[model samples]
Each structure stands twice: as structure tokens, then as C-alpha cells.
Target: MSHHDEEIDAAGRADEFLQVFKKGAEFTQDLLKENERLRFRVVQLEETLKEKGHDTVDESPDAIELKKKIEVLEQEKEEILGQIKVVEEENQNFANRYIEIEEENNMLANLYIASYQLHSTLDFKEVLQIILEIVINLIGAEEFGVLLLDEKTNRLEPVASEGLVTSELPSVAVGEGIIGEAVHSGENYFIDSMEGYERDFEKPIVCIPLKIKEHVIGVIAIYKLFTQKDEFTNVDYELFTLLAGHAATAVFSSRMYSDSERKLSTIQGFIDLLTK
Candidate 1:
């Protein structure tokens, strides 16, 4: 089955689980109320027997029948309590599962929105800003840089950065360091252990290579993550994979559009001069 279909099915199951949990909770409440009534009735019967005197009550058939009825009521109360306990446990499990599924669905919705925004713009700067926003807000990166490959220099040059000095960010040769290696091999690089990770100018925590098919175009080097973000989740990895493809296409398309506009302006200027 398709990934989207699986997500939809999971959402449906979450809704069903929630309905069952609600029903179980209502049933538990009814059981508790019935148990309270049974206890009250048992108390009334015992008080009557006490007032009648123990010896007289033991000899009476009516008192003996009352005692048997009290015993049966006590047994029924115990059974109800047991049923309530089991239902409570089942409700708790269902609630937890529903929460997990809800989180997954929310993440999927965010990814869809991000993907849409990435392709909605053709302006170069706007495209870059959207990518940066995805990395910061979605991926939870606090310090990172976007570097595009400079064909003439055969190096990756920093185009934009956050929480870092852009001028201090050095250009990397195509196959030299960690960032460069990702571009050269067209593969992502990330540290498995993020505990106590400190920012390093020479090494980044994560390096994602932006590519168009097999050709690598740029690199996103994240030095550190936000303080609250202790470790990466499955959704974070999915976002990174989405960025690698969609972000690259957006940037490449914008650059081509800008170049074409410049060429068109130059041609128009020459045609006006010839007419004059």
C-alpha cells in the first residue's frame, strides 16, 4: 500500500480507539454508581438486624432471608468492581495509542504544507528563506549554513547562515572536509550521538547534500540544534529527506528564471539601440 494510504488508515484507527475509550469510561462510571447503591442497601439491612436483637433475628425466617440477599448483593458488587478495573486499564492503553497516532498525523500534515510552500515560489531569495525556515522551525537546527557549489571555483560557498558568522564560514573544496565529502559523494552525513554535542567550526552535526538526480548542487551543514531538541526523531529524518529533493529543485528553478530574465533584458536593450 502507499504511504499516504497507511497514514489515513492509522488515523481512522485512532478515531475508532477513542470512541471505544469513551464508552469504557462511561461504563466504569455506571459500575461505580451501582456499587455505591449496593453498599447503601447492605448497610440498611445490617442496621435493621442489629435493632431487632441477634438471637431473635437468628430464629426468624425473614431475617435469615435478608442475610442471604445481603450476601448475594456483596458478591455482585465485587464482580462489578473487577469489571471496572479491567475497563480502566483498557481505556488507558487506548488513550496512549491514540496520542501516538495523533502525533504522527500532525507531522505528516506539516510535511505536506512545507512541501507545498517550497514549490510555491520562484524568486531566488524567497526560495532560500523558505528552506532556512524549514531547517530551523521543522528540523530544529539552531546553527546552520546553506552553501551552494561554485562551478568556477570548484568549491562550496556559503550563501546564507543562521546563528553563525557568514564571513567566518570558510569555503570548502569539493572533496576536502565533512561538508565537502557529502557534496562529493552525494550522501547525507550526521552524528548518531547528539548528547553533549558542542558546536565545532570544522565539523557539523549534520550535513545534507542537495541534489538533482545524481548531480550534487549544494550542502546544508548544521552545527548545532536548539537546546530543547535533545535528539532526532523519525519525523526529523523524513523532513531532511524531503528537503534534499524539494529544496534543490526550488533553488535550481529560481536561478534559471533569474538568469533568463537578465538575458531577456539585455536582448531588449540591444534591439532598442538598433532601432534608434
Candidate 2:
């Protein structure tokens, strides 16, 4: 063959070799990029598994440690929740105790006021009126009567009453009905309602004996409690004790004081007339 033709053939072979080399270089670069991307993805998966406290396929010591830490955190969270619940219950109990103390203080204040009012007057009629007022307002009694014992007949005679028909009251002997029994025993009596007593008369729910020393001179009968009160409380019992111990003494002292004052004034007037 001619030399020019041989040279053209060699150049064509060289051009083909260049194209093959370029293609191989591009394939190698693509393989390197793909390897790097796979390496980064593996790192991401390991970090995610460790953070989630999960054992990956490798099951490394770090994963095991992370799982134990997660378990501890879960237990601590439960303990914290339990502690919070306990604190809440304690707070509720404290609040309830505070309210109870406040109520007791108020009850004591009422008792003091009632006692003060009982002793503040000297008029015989006024003393009876004050006793009735205390029973109605402080003790929350709807129907009640103050009965003074007759020395000669030994029977009860009502002096003051509210919400009860005076004519309906029957004559009670010294040891007969609830009021009479309280007066005889020198103790307080209580009933829930009028279940067994006579239906003709209003049945008294409570009877308190008024006493000076050991002698019961009168009785207080409560027919029905106020609607707001369901039953008597400890404070109510305290009030009954106060009345039982002090009511008769207060009434007697006021009567004696008035009678003495009247006698002294009469004596003074007689002395002045004689001097003139």
C-alpha cells in the first residue's frame, strides 16, 4: 500500500483509542462518587440507630450502652410522674385541713358571741329573749322553747318559744317526756326526727337541761333543726354545754341584781324622807 494511505489508517486507530480512554475515565469518576455517597449514608444510619437506642445489624457496644441509658431514663420519668402525683395529693390535703381549721375558728367565734350576749343583759325578760335569739341564730334551730320549772307544781312551763304552737305543748312531769327526762337526768338528749313520739304534738329533736350546780331549773326543747343543718356537730354540743352550765346562773343573777337595786332605792328614799 502507499505510505499516505498507511499513515491515514494509523491516525484513525489513534482517534479510536482516545475515545475509549475518555469513556473509561468517566466510568471511573462515577464509581468513585457512588462509593463516597454510600460511605456517608452508612455513617448517617449508624448515628440514627445509636440515637434511637436500637441495636443495628452490627450490635456494637455503643448501641448496647445507649439502650441501657434509654431504659434508665424511662424509669426515671415514671418516678418523676409518681412524685408529682404525690405532691398534688399532699397539696389537696393541706388545702382541706386549712379549710377545716377556718371553720373551727368561726364556730368558736360564734360561741363567744353567744356567751357574751347571754351575760350582757340584767333584765329578766331580756335574758329570756337573748337565750331564744342564741338558739335560733347560732344553733340553727327552727322550732324550740324555753321552759322554766314550777317550784310548787314540779311541772315545766314555757316562757319563750318560736315556730311552735304554744297550745300544742302538753304538761310534762319532772321525769316524763324527753324534756322532762333531760331535766331529771341533768343531761342533754338528742333525736334525729319525730318517728316514735306523739304525732299530735311537734316532736322535739333535742332537749337540754339548764342547771345551776347540780340542780336543773329549766329545760330547752328543740323541735326541729334549721333546714341548712342536717345534724348536730361537735361545736353544737359545745354550745349546749355552755347553755347548760351558764344559762340558769345568768338568769338568776340578773333577777337578784334587779331586786336588790329596787330594794336599795326604796331604802334610800325612806332614809331621805326621815332626814327631811
Prediction 1 TM-score vs. true:
0.67
lDDT leader: 1
In model 2, which residue pairs have backbone atoms overlapping below 3 Å? Answer: none
After superposition on all C-alphas, the RMSD of every candidate to the true structure, in Å, is 35.5, 8.3
Candidate that would win on TM-score: 2
Q: Relative to the true structure, how large is the alpha-carbon lDDT of every model?
A: 0.91, 0.84
What's each prediction's clash count? 0, 0
Task: Point out where model 1 deviates above 4 Å.
Answer: 1-86
The stretch of ten residues in a row with the least summed lDDT in candidate 2 is 194-203
Error of 2 at 201 (Å): 5.7
